[model samples]
Target: MRAAGRAAPTSDPAADASDLRVIGRVAPHLWPPGDREARARVVAALAFLLLAKFATVATPVAFKYAVDGLNDAAADPRAVLLSLPVWLVLAYGAARLASVGFNQLRDAVFARVGQRALRSLALSTFRHVHALSLRYHLGRKTGGLSRIIERGVKGVDFLLRFLLFSIGPLALELAMVAVIFLVVFDLRYFAVIVLTIGLYVWFTFKVTEWRVKIREKMNAEDTDANQKAVDSLLNFETVKYFGAERREADRYDRAMAGYEAAAVRTATSLAGLNAGQALIITAGLVAVMAMAAQGVLQGRLTVGDFVMVNAYMIQITLPLNFLGTVYREIRQALVDMRAMFGLLDQPPEVRDAPGAAPLRVGAGAVRFEHVDFGYDADR
Candidate 1:
């Protein structure tokens, strides 16, 4: 998805269709145009991933059938146990093999796409930063600007990885599982799962959003204090000569105290959020178990059904937990991305004029205009 670079124009419709199929198949509309080689790699990687997710979904159904078979042959303990091992081996083996293949493919694709993306971002930032008029950079804190860029680049990578890999498949899995529960067992279980998931998500956002704000403020204060500390250390002789060591120490203490308070506030809020999540998960588990027990007492479900329900609950919750975290991170990432793109959008003060021809080698002469520079009035 490196869209910044120039792309070759394709005059052949068939070729263009082939290229688009590869892009849609691999990255699935996540990133924009990229180099030709990278697009091919992405297509292959996506095909592998599609198969892998199907394998993951099929595994549980395998267990469901194996359980039904065992229940039918309950009289012969040997036959039941034998069927169990075969099914387990098949399901586990298939999943493990698919996972390994997917990982290899993913790594190869990541290497190519990752490098290109980083290169594009770095070049964009470097060119933009240098092109700025002096007054603009002077008005901004260089250290703060640097931090913004660092966080922004990292955010882009995070979004790309999760959007295509984790979020999409996990969402599909959740929907399928819900349908299975609704169609096979009881729709009530689906309701329970969805409800718990909703509450879990609500708390995660409310808490993380609050914390991110506090954290940002704390970070800004910390950066200012750090800069001051560095300034003092660099001018240590002057500080001692002016008898200002105690004053600098007091300033540092105040900064640290504010940081500590903000940290405690964030921690306390998170603890409360975690406690709420745990309570929701525990309640959901108990409800599912109770329903399973009732089904067993009424002969509506077998021991295998109980096991399946429990397993499904676990699979459902794990992703629910993940979704909660991902949601929070995404909100923060969006904020970070805005700042990064804002930086990226800055137009250069001096750019090549349209239709400007390149200077011919050995035929150009260098010239300097009457340029004046000043750092400060004191200079």
Candidate 2:
């Protein structure tokens, strides 16, 4: 236990170590040994994820072809009536639909796996809290402890969903888009894509790292406020007897005041982060579109190609837009999970001896032989 005056833990080498440890601990639950059904579900989910990403990457290509075919048909009225690019249009719509459908299927299939892991981890944490010695509980804050478990459980769910769905798929799609740019379009397009991605990722991570501190401050105040409220309410009769309602309200208000300040900082920092991200994304879009337009004017690429570049840029931007928020939440979740895992790391104060026989009573009788107990062993 930390002293009251001690500062809250920040992200450091030790915290990173704990975060890795938590991931390792939770991994087994997600992919439990001897659970064929869970394993099968995981495999199916991956299959769907791949299909979804492939469809997503192909959507822009299909659209490009549809546009090209329509442009050709427009050159001749007879061709316009005969060759309306129906097949290309259908393929474009189908690809878009398939992308969404497969993504939904992946989530539906993996829902069981995520929820199971959440339940298992939550139950383990609950039982471990109960098993800890009374001395430990007596010194703990119930409200804070409960909040840790609640946040940790929620963290597990978010990590499972986003780490697999958002992060992995984003990487896969980015790679595919890069390949398309390199193969079908000019190398310049690919270079721009790579540079933009690099800048966007680096900026998002740096800003999010700073925001994490503000988030931690907010969480600490929130936990403190909750603890004060719960503690006051639990001792309601004592407060009434002592006529200290005003004192209790003042204490709670102080905690809330800190929370309010921290909350405001979080919101303001988030706005700045969003603004910076938007600037980067917009700059990338403009640069790429300008190059594409130049290619069209120089007869190096068609109007359809310009539109395709725009489509792919929009596709990439959609995920990049949320990158900051997702990264921040994941970091905060790690912090929460680390706290919960700390409880699980504690060794029980009492345990049955190895291979100890169970007590059997024919006629129950209390027996005491030199038994002495004190809450503090030092006493």
Candidate 3:
């Protein structure tokens, strides 16, 4: 359980109760040094990720080769006598396959380790909750608490896998793309791409924070609406006895109306965010494209180079959307995970003695049929 020699987290009444530091606390359990196999799995996953990244970068290059080859063949039909175009086409497909193959392989390798971590967190929280005092359970709602547990389970899994596979990998790929632009293309391309991404991120974070607040309001209203409906249904007999069905329906409708308005606001704001991100990306693409087109006009770049530049930008830019999604999800999910794991932070009212030994029994040991316990003399 508590990572041998490590004391369990205690409830600190004086501690800042903002975020529970969920990721920080539970992340280490994902690959405990005690498990050599987990370390190996992570290493293997990283290797696959590296290969996937290279393959992804190479895909645009292969496309460029194919495009250039065909363009040359067309310019000089005599060159068509050679079948290099055919091979280039095949190379393009191979590059695409390699990129996809390695990405899937990376996910497969890391999945088990992520699940193992999820299980550990689940087990730790499960045991911790059972160890807490009866009052904690008495004060909880089974339905709401179970939902928290489910979402928390999902949160931990997503946090581990997404951070490792999505967020971290995307950043690495973007860096690699920037480096490629600088080394193979031009500095202007690199600068434009970087600046655009910076603005895109800044704009997304700013708008997304605003949207998060709206979503929270919507969720709160939705929860209130659901609670009203549930309470109304459960007290149906009372409503019927009083002939208050119409009144109950009116209250429920009012609650839902509030929720509907909040939901609409959330949808409307999300559209704005999407539009802003698209504008940023499109502007960046146009700037880069203008540079690439100029190279073509000057005969400094072949059609293939233009195609490659476009392809690479598309590849690099697609993840910008996911990067924003990941940032928002991590913030939201961590909030849930913090609450779920907060149960673990509650100091157990009961625990073993500092050096308690296991109870010894003979071959035929008797077990108690009934037991009694107490917290103190007052109880």
Question: Which one wins on lDDT?
Answer: 2
TM-score of each: 0.77, 0.93, 0.81
Candidate 3, poorest ten consecutive residues by summed lDDT: 1-10
Stretches of candidate 2 exceeding 4 Å from the true structure: 1-15, 77-84, 356-363, 377-379
The better-scoring model by TM-score among 2 and 3 is 2
Expressed as tens digits, the lDDT of each residue in 268-342 for candidate 1 is 666676777778888988998899889989999877778778777777677666664665554445455556767
Q: Which sections of candidate 1 miss by over 4 Å? A: 1-34, 71-74, 77-85, 96-104, 225-253, 357-379
lDDT: which is higher, 2 or 3? 2
State the displacement of the C-alpha of residue 351, model 3, in Å, after optimal TM-score superposition.
2.7
lDDT of each candidate versus the true structure = 0.68, 0.84, 0.77
By TM-score, how accurate is candidate 1?
Answer: 0.77
- Which prediction has the highest TM-score against the true structure? 2
| Model 3 C-alpha RMSD to native | 7.5
lDDT of candidate 2 over 1-379, digit per residue (tens):
0001111243467866776787788889989999999999999999999999999999988898889889888867676645747688899999999999999999999999989999999999999999999888887888888988999999888889887789889999999999899999878889999989998887777666666566777788899999999989999999999999999999999999998997787777767777777787888899999999999999999988999999999999988777766666666777788888888989999998999999877977889999987777653
When sorted by lDDT, best at the front, the candidate numbers are 2, 3, 1
lDDT for residue 46 in candidate 1, whole number 0-100? 77
